[model samples]
Target: MKALVLAGGSGTRLRPITHTSAKQLVPVANKPVLFYGLEAIAEAGIHDVGIVVGETHAEIEAAVGDGSRFGLRVTYLRQEAPLGLAHAVLIARDYLGEDDFVMYLGDNFIVGGISDLVSSFEQDRPTARIMLTRVADPAQFGVAELDRNGRVVGLEEKPEVPKSDLALVGVFLFTAAAHEAVVELKPSWRGELEITDALQWLIDEGHRVEATVISGYWKDTGNVTDMLEANRLVLESVESRLDGEVDAASDLIGRVVVEEGASVTRSRIVGPVIVGAGTRVSNSYVGPFTSIGANCAIIDSEVEYSIILPKASISGARRIEASLIGHYAEVTPAPDTPKAHRLVLGDHSKVQISS
Candidate 1:
């Protein structure tokens, strides 16, 4: 079987950052989210892969290259617009050919890869298989309604009135039979060919469509909150390793990884934290669940549960928590000498002043 990974979506939810970078390329634990999916596909023994890319195709190509880095031969499929998931399958028809394939969303993070899922699909050989997880807001995702026997009976895409809390996870297994369903689909109300519709079509036509309600950790890292949470979860399993310099003045607590060329002086780093290669942390407090990207500088600041992208600097900042700082960004204290209030307020804008 092959793999089709979708890496093309204008991530409006992660604006300003996504404005400059592809959402899939956003780092979790200093590794690109897209890389995780690719690695998982490789681990599943799928050597032939096709990556669906959009406007950031060049960037994705540069980052992934020939995919040899992930032990897979990747073919890049260009999607001109942000069409629906079904449309991605439609465009990848040529690359997918007659083989069964797995469709994975690049920004989604699933703990303990999809090897078992692939194994099950190979064994059971269902026409289409979807992974579902119980979510708080089913309306935010494609939801599946199972019958009394836990068989998938109904599927809806972002329904206003959801029939079930089982939301579709980003991983899907499909045989070549799915091509017949996707081709017969019409654009949904949202002006895109929904994948949920394709699966529904298979069910309507007497094809075997299966669903698995997964209890494992899965996250669609589309927004900032989810990104930070996924980073925290990944960091939890990190082992303590010090390949870089940690001066006597520094105190490194549990499970901290100071990567090669990184230096820590007069700083205190708590557990499950990773300081990327060439990063410098001096006179700072690096708390838990933090991943500081390569070449970053943190001086006289305190940061926790945050992701500091490559080349970003946080100096003299009081504290930062649960934040996603973009690459090459700077976080420094404002000028203290000019403490007087300045007014350039906009209409209907609310401001809080410390008096």
Candidate 2:
């Protein structure tokens, strides 16, 4: 079996950040979300992989060259536009010839990888298998309605009136039968060949389109909230390792991993936090659930539950929490001066000034 990973979305939801970087490359615990997927695929023993690349193709290609880093031979399939999921399979037809394959969405974070999912599919040899999870807002996802026997009865893509709370997780297993279904598909209302539609066609044709509702943690880290949440979850299992220098003035609390060359002086770091290599945290409070990327400087600042990208600097900032600072960004307090009122007041508006 092969693996097809989609790393080609515009990631409009991540906005300004996505404008500068590929969404799949966004770090969760200083590791690209797509890297985790590739690692998982390799762990599943799928060495021949196809990565569907889109607008950010160059970035994706540069990061994952030849896939040797992940112990896989990666074939990059370029999609000119942000077409639907089935469209990815359509483009990867050559790479994914008649063999069974697993399709993984690049930006999705699945805790405890998809090794078992792949194992089950290989053992049972389902015609088509989908991973589903109960979500609060089924309307926001491709939902599946299962029969009383827990068989997949119907599937809808971002339905206005969802029939079930079981939302399609980003991992899917498919055999040669799915290719036949995709060949006959017409573009959906979104002008894209949604994978959900292809699966629905398979269901109509009496194919064994199976669904497994996994209880493990899974998140589509498309937006800032989800990104931070995924980061928090990944940091849960971080083991305490201090390869860097922690001075006597610094207090390192639980489960903190200070990478080699990182220095902590006159600061307090409460963990599940990771200070990346060459980073220096001086006279600051680096709190829990934070991943400070490589070579960053956090001087005289208080940051917690935030991700500071590589080379970013935070100095004299009072507090920063639940934030995602981009690379080479700066966070510092405003200049202090004598208090005075300087305003162009609106008409008939109340005003107050501190002197």
Candidate 3:
């Protein structure tokens, strides 16, 4: 079986960051989200992989290269436009050819990987298998409805009135049978051929469609809140290691990993924090669940629960919290000025002044 990774999305939700960089390349614990999916695929023992890319094709290609870095041989399939998930499969037909394949969304994060799911699918050889997870907001995702026997009886894409709380996780297993389903289905009202529709077609035609309700952690890291949450989740498992230099004036608290060439002086870093290689943290407070990316500088600042990307500089800021700072960005206090309240007096208006 081969692996098909869908890395070609507009990523409209993560804009202005997406405007500059590919969403799949966004780092979680200093590792690109796409890299995690690729590594998982390699670990699953599938080396012949195809990556579907969009207009940001050059960037994706540059980052992944021949995929040998991850111990896999890659083939890049370009999609001129991101019509839909089904469209991705439609274009990748040649690369996927008669073999069963697993489709993983590039921006999604699954903590434990999908090796088990792939193993189960290979054993049973279902026409199509989807991973489902109970989500609080089923309306935000493609939801599935199961019958009395736990069979996938219905599928809906972002339904206004969801029939179940079981949302579709980003990982899917499909046999050669799915290629016919994609061709037979028509585009949805949204003008895109959604993969949900293709699965629904299989369900309507009495094909064997299976579902696995995931109990492990899974997140679609599309927006800032989910991105930060994923960062926190990945960091929680980090082991404590001080591979870098630390001055006597610096105090390290809980679990922290200071990579080689990183230095901490007169700063206090609490547990579950990572100071990337070549980074310098001086006279600062690095609190929990914060990942400072490689070669960054944090001076005279207090940051917590934030993801600072590579080469960023944060100095003289009072406090930074719950933020996703992009690469090479600078976070510093604004020029100090007097605080005053100015009002334009209007006719027949009453105003009070406090001094």
Candidate 4:
């Protein structure tokens, strides 16, 4: 079996940041989100891999050249336009010929990996197998309805009124039979050939379609909030190590990792947190669930539950929390002014002022 990773999409939700960088390359715990998926594929023992890339193909190629670093031989397949998930499979037919393959979304984060799921698919050889998870907002995702016997009987893409609360996770397993289903599918009302439609076609044709409900953590890191949450989740598991220099004036508390070449002076870092390589934290407070990327500088500020990208700086700010700061950005105190209110008086003007 081979692996197909979909790394092509314009991440409009993460604007400004995605405007400059690929969404899949966004870091979670200082590691790109795409790297996790690549590691999982390598762990599954699938070395012949194909990556589907869009116009931002160069960035993906530069990061994952030849895939030899990840123990996989990669073939890059370009998609001129992101028509849909089914369209990706349609274009990758030659690379995926005759072999069963697993499709993983590059920006999706699935904790505990997919080794077990791949093992199960290889054993049963279903026409298609989809991972499902119970979500409160089923309308936001492709939903599935199961019969009384726990068999998937119906599927819909972003339905207005979902029949079930089970939402489709980003991982999919498909056999060679799925190629025929892709050809038979028509574009949806949205003008894109959704993968959900292809799986539905397989079911309509009496081909075996299975669903595996995942109990582990899974997140589609499409927006800023989810990305920060993913960063926190991964950082929570990091082991504390003092690989960098710390002055006697600095105090470290609980599970903090200071990477090599990083320096901390006249600051207090309360962990479960990480200070990336070459980053400097001085005269500041580094609180929990915060990750400072490589070569950043934090001075005279207090930050908690935030992610600061590389080469960024935060100074003279009192406090910042739950923020996703972009690369090379700067945050400093606003210029101060007199406290007294200034108002221009007019003839017979009615006004109320609070003291």
Task: Give the worst 10-residue stretch by lDDT in candidate 2.
Answer: 340-349
User: Mind giving the per-residue lDDT tens digits that candidate 4 earns over 48-95?
Assistant: 999999978999999999999999999999999989999999999999
Q: Write the number of the candidate with greater lDDT, choosing between 1 and 3.
A: 1
Global lDDT of each candidate: 0.89, 0.87, 0.88, 0.87
Q: What is the lDDT of residue 126 in candidate 3?
A: 80
lDDT for model 3: 0.88
Write down the lDDT that model 1 would get: 0.89
Which of candidates 2 and 3 reaches a greater lDDT?
3
Clashes of each: 0, 0, 0, 0
lDDT of model 4 at position 193: 90
Q: Highest lDDT among the candidates is held by which one?
A: 1
Best by TM-score: 1
Q: After superposition, how far is residue 172 of candidate 4 from its true place, in Å?
A: 0.2
Off by over 4 Å in 2: 335-355
* Ranking 1 against 4 by TM-score, winner: 1
- CA RMSD per model (angstroms): 4.5, 6.1, 7.0, 7.4
lDDT of 3 at 104: 93
TM-score of every candidate = 0.94, 0.93, 0.93, 0.93
Better of 1 and 3 by TM-score: 1
Window of ten residues with lowest summed lDDT in model 1: 339-348
